[model samples]
Target chain A: MPDLGISVLFKGKNLPRLLGGLWAALRISLISVVISFPLGILLGALMTLKNPFVKAAMRIYLEFIRIMPQMVLLFLFYFGTTRAFGWDLTGETASVIVFVLWGTAEMSDLVRGCLISFPAHQYETSEALGLGKAQLYRYIIIPQAVRRLIPLSVNLVTRMIKTTSLILMIGVVEILKVAQQIIEANRTASPNAAFGVYLAVFFLYFIACWPISMLAQYLERKWG
Target chain B: MDHVTKRFGNHTVLDDISLTVHRGEVIVVIGPSGCGKSTLLRCINALEKIQGGEIKLGNEKIEYGSKRLPSLRQKIGMVFQNYELFPHLTVLGNIQLAPVKVQKRNLAEVQAEAIGWLDRVGLEGRENSYPRELSGGQKQRVAIVRALCMHPEILLFDEVTAALDPEMVREVLDVMLALAAQGRTMLIVTHEMRFARAAADRILFLDGGKIMEDSDPETFFTHPQTERARRFLSTFQFDNIKKL
Candidate 1:
C-alpha cells in the first residue's frame, strides 16, 4: 500500500550502487569458478586412479573440506588465517580464496563422479578399438561425460553464485549488503523500505540463476 | 600365441593358453561361459594383459607388458558382447571415429566408407541416429563395421551376438557370415554353434582355460575329442535333432 523505493532507486545514485553490488557478486563467482574448474577436474581424474597414496591423500583433503561448514571455512579464512598464518587478508580476498577452495572441492567430486559413471564396457571397447588413454577419453568417454557433467556442474556453479551472498557476512558489500544499507538509509522515509529492498535482491538473484537452473533440467532430460 | 596366460589375483582366468590364428581364417572359440573364451579373445589385442607367455599378432610377438600394444592394437579390432557403440556419436560418427581419429585418415573418406559399410549392413538410413535409437541387432552391426572401418588385420568378436533377442541373433550372424565370406581373419568367441559350423574354418574348444580341442568345425562338431567338448556340443546336437 506504501510507495515502493523505485522513485528513490531511479532518483539518485542508489541504483548504480545496487548494480555495483551485483557486479561484485558476479566477479567473485566468475573468478572462483574459472580458477577452480580445471583444478577440480584434474583432482577428480586423479581420484579415479587406483594408486594407494594418491587416493589416501586426496580422500583426506576432500573429506576435511567436505564436512567442514562453508561459513566456518569463511570465518577460518577471514579471521583465523589472519591470526594463525600471520597474513594480511581483506574480506574480498578471503571470500575469493575461501570460495575457490570450496568450489574446487565441490566441483572435483562432480567431475570424478561423472568421469567414472560411464559403463566399464566403454573403457574396454575403446581400448579394443586401439584408442590410447588420452584418445579414449577425448573421443568416447569425455563426450558422454560432458553430457552428465554439464547439468550437475551448472547446478554447482549456480549454487556457488547464491552462496556468494554469504560473503556479505565478512563485509564484501555484495547485493545483500547493499540491500541492507538501502533499508537502513530509508527506515523512516519508507517504513516498508526493507520489504522493497529485499524483494529486489530476490529478483536479482532469480534473474541471474533461473536460466542456469533451467539449463541443468533441460540437459538432464535430453541426456538421460 | 605360445603359452599366453592371464590371471586375476590368484584366480587364473587363462591358464597358459596356446593357439595360432591363421590369416583369412575364421577360428570360432566355443566353451562354457567361464571357460576364458572371451578372455582369450581379449588377450589377442592386449585388452586384457597376459601375465605370462607371448601373443604373436601379424609380425609382432607381444610379451608381458609390451609397449607396442597401442600401435599393435591397430591390427586387431574387437566387437564386444554388449555392442559398445560410442553412445554420444551418431551411427555414422561411431563408424568413422576410429578411422578418422586413430588411423589419422581423412574424415570425408572415412565418413563415406562408413556410409558404405552401413548400407552393406542394411543400416544406411540410420546414419544420423544415436546408438540408443538403434535396435540391438543394428547396434551390433554398427559395432562390427566400426571395427572394419579401421582395416585391422584381424577381427576379434567377443560373443558379439550374445546380448540380442532370439530373432535378432540371426540378423547379426548373417552380417558376420558376410564378413567371413570376404576371407577376413576372424577370431570369434561365441555360443552360436550353427554359425560356428557355417562360417568357421576351425573351432577351438576351450575348457578350464585350456584349449581342450582345436580341430576343423566338421570334426569338432561331429566327433569331439574331449568329453567336455562332447558335452558342450551335445546341446547343439540336441537342437539339430529337435529340428529333425
Candidate 2:
C-alpha cells in the first residue's frame, strides 16, 4: 500500500525469470538427491557391517565429509580438481558432483543411525525364526527402519534445496543468481528492485521447503 | 547336545555339559539367575557358539557357522523371555513370515496354518492386529504360536512367562502345557516353579555351569539329589503361605 515496490515482481518477464531460476535450483538439488538417496542407503548398510576394516573405512569417510565444509568440497571439485587433474568439469556438473558427495555422506550417516538404533531383538528374533541374513534385512529390518528414515530424509531434502543457494558462487545460474541479474538489470527502472526481488526469492524458498516439511509431519503423524 | 562347553571370554557359562533330548521329551532346565539355563537352551538352538561339543538334531550336527545353519534353525524354534514380535507386522504376518518367505511355502497355505496356530493359542481373529495392539499375555501366546507355526522338531523357550503379569503368566504357561501334552519336544527355562514342576518330564537342575541334578521331576522337586538343589527348591517353598 505504501509503494513497497511489489510491482517489480509482476513487471515484464521478471516473474517468469524468477520461476525459471527456481526451477534451476530445484533441478540441481533433485538430480543430486535422486543419485545420492540409494547410494546413501547402500553405503549406510555397509557402515553397519561388523567387520572392523569396513567400519573403520566408513568412519574415516564420514569424518572426512563432516569435517570439511561443503563450500571447500565444491571448490575442490570445480576449480582445484579441474586444474590439478586436467579434467574439464562444467560448473553445473561440478556442483552436482560436490552435492552428491556431500549429500551421500550426510544421508548415509542418517541411514546408519536409523539402522543401528533398531532394537537388537529384531535381529535375534529374525534369526531364531530362521530368516536368512538377506531375508531378515529385506522383510524385517528395512521395513521398520524406512518409517524412521522417511521423516529424516525429507528434512535432508529441504536442507539440500536451501544449500543449492551456495552454488551461485561457482557461476551456477540458479535462483539467487537469477535474482541478482534481475536486481542489477532493474536497478535504474525500479529503485527498490533488490528488496522486491529478494522478498520474492524468500517466498520461493519458503514455497519449496514448506510442503516438504508438511509432508514429513503428515507422515510422522500417520506412521508414528 | 553332548559335551557342550560355552565360554564368554574366560568365564565358562556352560562347562562340559552333555545332554540328550529324545523325541517328544520335555526337558525343563531351572536354576538360580545366571546359572546358564537360558544359555543351555540357546546352545541347542545354535544361537550360542559352543566351544566344545556337538549338537545333533537327528543325524545332522548343529555347528556354528554351518552352511546348513539356517535350515537347522528352521527345525528348532526358540522363544525368548521378552516376546520379540516384529512391531511392523501383524499377528498373522509374524507367524507366517518364516514359513512363507524362508521355507518358500505357498502363501495361502502358510496363512491358513498360521491362523490355525493362532486359534490354538486363543489369538483367533487377531490376524490383522499388530503386536502393540495386544496385551502382554496375548503377545506371548502369539510368540508361542509364531514358533509353533514353524513346525520345528523342537522348541526352546527361555523364560517365556518370566516377563508377564501374574495373570498373564497362566495363559502362556497353559499354551506350553498344551504343547507338552500334544507330545511336542521342548526345552524350557523358567523361574515359575509350579509351571516347571507341572510341565517338566525330567528336570535338569543347573548350578555353576553344571547339571547338579538330572532326574525325574518328582525326584528333583520333592527329593532333590544334591545339597545345592535342596537349597534351590527350598526358596520356592512358601511355608508360611499355608497359615494365610
The top-ranked prediction according to lDDT is 2
DockQ scores for all predicted structures: 0.69, 0.73
lDDT tens per residue, model 1, B1-244: 9888899899898988778788899999999989999889877877677889988876788543467777778778889999888888899888887777888999999988888989999887899999999999999999998999989999999998899999999999999999999999999999998899999999998988998999998899888899998887776554456432
Clashing pairs in 1: none
What DockQ does predicted model 2 obtain?
Answer: 0.73
What lDDT score goes with residue B15 in model 1?
89
Candidate 2 lDDT by residue in tens digits, B102-128:
988899988888888888788889999
CA-RMSD of model 2: 2.5
| Candidate 1 residue spans exceeding 4 A from truth | A1-11, A218-224, B236-244
lDDT of 1 at B111: 85
Q: In terms of TM-score, how similar is model 1 to the real structure?
A: 0.92
**Best model per TM-score:** 2
Model 1 global lDDT (CA atoms, 0 to 1): 0.86
